[model samples]
Target: MNTPYKNAKLHDCRDAFTATLEALAGQNSDIVAVCNDSVGSSKLGNFREQFPERLINVGIAEQNMVGVGAGLANGGKIPFVCAAAPFLTGRALEQIKADVAYSQTNVKLVGISSGMAYGELGPTHHSIEDFAWIRALPNVPVIAPADRAETAAAIRWAAQYEGGCFLRLSRVGVPDLLPDDHVFELGKANMLRDGHDVTLIANGVLTHRAMIAAALLEARGISARVLNMASVRPIDEAAIIDAAHATGAIVTCEEHTIFGGLGSAVAEVVVDHAPVPMTRLGVPGVFAHTASANTLLDDFGMAPDAIAQSAEALIGRKG
Candidate 1:
């Protein structure tokens, strides 16, 4: 509720992610790191250094890497399968579905550099479709953390959780949105700021952007509430209902496509529980052009000003 983080310095969530994983690994001997030749990119260097034998690198073979992770889990080891999101979800999807999801393995699938984090490298590296692909599966719990604190908390949760889960993490630096001691609750949305005019919902890199959009709306004399809806699959439906009935207008933002990502998930809840005017902001149904991550976000009308404008327009439809 405090605004001390209004101008907070930015942090890359991967730092907190690996640090927490390492700390948990120290306590649980069964915890291990697995990767598809992405130890550095996945920020697992310290993990490899501390547990060299435990770091399994499959040399660019994502399918084999996921299979090995399943095998480790079957062998009673808690494997943290790490890789770039695009390849992890795209290349090894079948393996993930069969070995991890269908079998209900205890492998923690960590998708690093998710969404548009590799923005300059273009769409092939962009992981915009991961949420849709993974969330469609039966068993995996889909999650994306807003900042370093949430990333740490989610990692801790995954370590304790019994089945497979996808952790969507980005390399883009963001200011702290949650407290250091924040606890991760599965399928629960965190209300960052409260208001009455409209509600802005988002996760991952977009959560901070939503907060800024809420502030922009405030400056325009529109009271905006912000919700960090991190878990996409088992979404916080109760929060979505509260937002729809309380605010009457809702705006959902994400780093993924508007088709099947965070926005669509929230829309399903809003339409089912309480009909409300809504605006979904993200990459449209098109391949993103070459640019930096922030540039791509701005191009897709997800910048704070753009989100605020969308919310303002949607408020007109609230009846």
Candidate 2:
């Protein structure tokens, strides 16, 4: 069967995130954007221009920015602490642990340019460690929306969802992989294409790659399941188990380290519930050399063809 979302308009999920944040802020006076001098990169220019009072630029201090966000949350304001993913999650990790997660504050950590979005900018800028970092913390739901529609839905859901949450956004453009009005349900994986041979699981930018990989598998007479799994922390255990039982083999692709990211998340579920033959496609644990984000993904064997090849290889190991 053909996928519901085949060829669609490509869009940067960050644009949808900013647009939704601005609209939500207009509705709720308590909604505010706090960034570490990343208004332009985070694409909050229009937001800053519209409501200057609501947009707080903390000027390159990620730690202080998160601290301020926690303070604002304590004062009954919904603060979206936005910054580059590496700095926001890596630099202010302690703040995220103590003030936001441990304190149980209602602050939304908006990680802009997450994953390899800063590809070619070097390892210091890439946020390949974000998932492992944030997922290790308690009381924070780590989310990476699949596309623009899911990004908007996840933002809206985060606004209404009380307590702390991390919304991982990317500047890299991706084709619309979900329906126009898809709603994000926490811990639920959206099955884009179903097959009995093997399964391809991914989130964020890799979701589109997984879909393309599934198409390639179909061309070779091997049916492959495609899953858009955005919620990494509260992973969809049921779907993971079902995929294991149905497909007998699984392939996970992510724009993150193969050690402890989306692939690890899915593997945990499969290992605990139903152990199945699985292959993970991602950057090996190594500081990447200078290359564009897309180039890095392709280099690390996460390109669509690479993912499909991984899936094809995994099928041979299936019982």
Model 1 lDDT at residue 67: 95
Q: Write the per-residue lDDT of candidate 1 for residues 39-146, one digit (tens) a residue.
A: 899889999999898888989999999999999999999999999999999999999999999999998999999999999999999999998899899889999999
- Evaluated with lDDT, which candidate comes out highest? 1
User: Looking at model 1, which ten-residue stretch has the lowest summed lDDT?
Assistant: 1-10
Deviation from native of the Cα of residue 297 in model 1, angstroms: 0.3
lDDT minimum window of 10 residues, candidate 2: 1-10
Q: List the residue pairs that clash in candidate 2.
A: 120-291
State in Å the error of residue 300, model 2. 0.6
- Show where candidate 1 strays beyond 4 Å: 1-7
What lDDT score is found at residue 290 in candidate 1?
88
Residue 276 lDDT in candidate 2: 94
State the C-alpha lDDT per candidate. Answer: 0.93, 0.91
